[model samples]
Every structure is written in structure tokens, then in C-alpha cells.
Target: MRPEAEPAMKPVFAKIGKPVAAKFRPDPFQLASLEAIRDADCLVMAPTGSGKTWIAEEAIRSVFQKGGRCWYASPLKALTNAKWVEFGNHFDPANVGIVTGDTKENTDAPIIVGTTEILRNQLYDAMHSGENLNCDLVILDEAHFLGDLDRGVVWEEIMIYLP
Candidate 1:
């Protein structure tokens, strides 16, 4: 049997020589919301810049840390591009990828940022082609689009047919 690789050590001290750590200083509502969505899918309905992205970050981090892949889907190409840049900063670029109607990079990456239709099409392809599994968790970031007249079908397809 092949042996496992050794884990890399995280720097105990920051560049300034102080201990590096995460501070749990989220606001009351943020804390409550984080706790509420820790284990299940959430329907966050908050104003923009109210830290809704933080919840998505936490969920993505949780999945990635567990040695699993996360597929974050958006309704708009602009949002997909924005999320690609945002998540690329957090995860390694090689491990992070983007896919949309016009953009596709690192399609096999662990963390994928894509439009809902792109993901749906990928899922459909995977099923029809019988490819190996690729994703573990999928976060529909702007999930309220199920009410939209033009694009709701794509999101519904993803939610209904994802493996």
C-alpha cells in the first residue's frame, strides 16, 4: 500500500513574530446565522454587504477542509466571474476553477465557481457520460432566482439532478 504524505506545518507566528489565529468576533446576527447554517443548507435573505458572503465562505471552507470539493453556482456571468476572483484568493488558484458560458478554467479543480446552467450542463454530461464523481458540495449562492421567469429552470435542474 502507498503511504500517506506528511502534513505541512502551519507557521505558529506571523511575519511580525506574533501568534497567528482566527478571531471569533463576528457580530451577533452573523454569529447566529453562522450557527444556524453550520450543518444544513440555508436560505439567507439579507441586504448586500451585510456579510452574507461570510456564510458562504464558512460553508466552502468547511467542505474544502474535509478533503471534499465545493461547487459554488451563481445566476449571472458577472457574479460567477466575481466569485472566481474572490475564491481564487482564498484557495490555491490551481485548486480553484471557473466555468460559465464564456469562461472555463481548471474544470477538475476542487473548488469550482460557475454559473448555475454551466453546472447543470456539467452534471448532465457527467450522468450521460458516466464519469467519475467530481463535486461534494454545491452552494447556490443567489438561490432566490427560482422565482425568475427566464432562468429558474437551470437552478431547478441543478438542485434536482446533481449527483
Candidate 2:
């Protein structure tokens, strides 16, 4: 058999230009998430690129606008650091802080990003001190890690201790 063969379909060489600029509109589920977060605890589960981060940003925005505090926890330091920058861009650099195993800065900012372990430790400290966790809202990104074999305990502890 011949190893070389012509393409089955012609490549669209002309369709490779820059995509048309279009305004972004949230999906119905994203809108619903934003509404649900306003008055209640909400868990959003969607596929990648499905606007879960948008929902998070909006929730943080709502709280930040009202002079409230938000805690955003992810399972990894890399993700936590990325969100810190993203939230800083959306909410202003002075308003966002981060605390991980190796880094802690601006711990007094209105919006905080950190790993689940850090959050759990903070909860432990608050419990030990007889003080409440000073947070108005909490977002647990990569929340499915709650079922992970090794890391789930940290996430579970954070969930149990959060008020």
C-alpha cells in the first residue's frame, strides 16, 4: 500500500484570520449562578470554559462593592496565585491578597486568595482564638478535590470550619 495519501478534506486556508470581535454574554446558567450567590450558598459545577470563573468574579465583585470580604481558596498554590492576580485586576491590586505555604502578603485586603490548607489553618487559628472567620463570602475553586484521596482532608476541614 502507498504510504502517501492526499488529504480527505481540503484545508480552509482562508479561515485562519483573526476571529471576529464579539461581545460576551453569560450563559443562562452563569446568570442563574450570579443570582443564587447573592442570598444563599451556591455550588457551581460546569465544564471547562463554561464561565465558572465568571460566576466567581461576579460573586467577589458583589461582595467587594459592598465593603464585604471574600475568601477564595483553590487546591494548588499556582491556581491560587493566578486567581490573586485575576481578582486584583478585576477588583484592583490593593484590594486583593494572597496567603500560601510560602507566601503571605496583604493579609488584610478585602479579597483573599489562598490554598485550602492555608484557609483551614486560618480557621483553626480563629477557632483557637475564639474569634470568627472574618469573611462575608467564600469560593472554593477546584472543589471536586474535596473527594481527592490525599488533599480532600484539607478541603473537608476548610468546609467544616467555614461559617
**Model 2 stretches with alpha carbons more than 4 Å out:** 1-17
Positional deviation of residue 122's Cα in model 1 after best superposition, in angstroms: 1.4
Tell me the tens digit of each residue's lDDT in model 2 across 6-44: 464335544566789999999999999999998788989
Best by lDDT: 2
Clashing pairs in 1: none
State the lDDT of candidate 1 residue by residue for 1-163, as single tens digits. 9864454423422334756798866667776766776666556788878888887887778778999898899988998999998888988788889999998899888899998888888888888898834877788878889888998888888877875
What is the lDDT, from 0 to 100, of the residue 120 in candidate 1?
Answer: 88
Per-prediction TM-score, please? 0.75, 0.88
What TM-score does prediction 2 earn?
Answer: 0.88
**All-Cα superposition RMSD per candidate:** 12.6, 4.8
Superposition-based RMSD of candidate 2 using all C-alpha atoms, in angstroms: 4.8
Candidate 1 residue runs with Cα over 4 Å from true position: 1-24, 32-38, 130-133
Where is model 2 poorest over a 10-residue stretch in terms of lDDT? 5-14
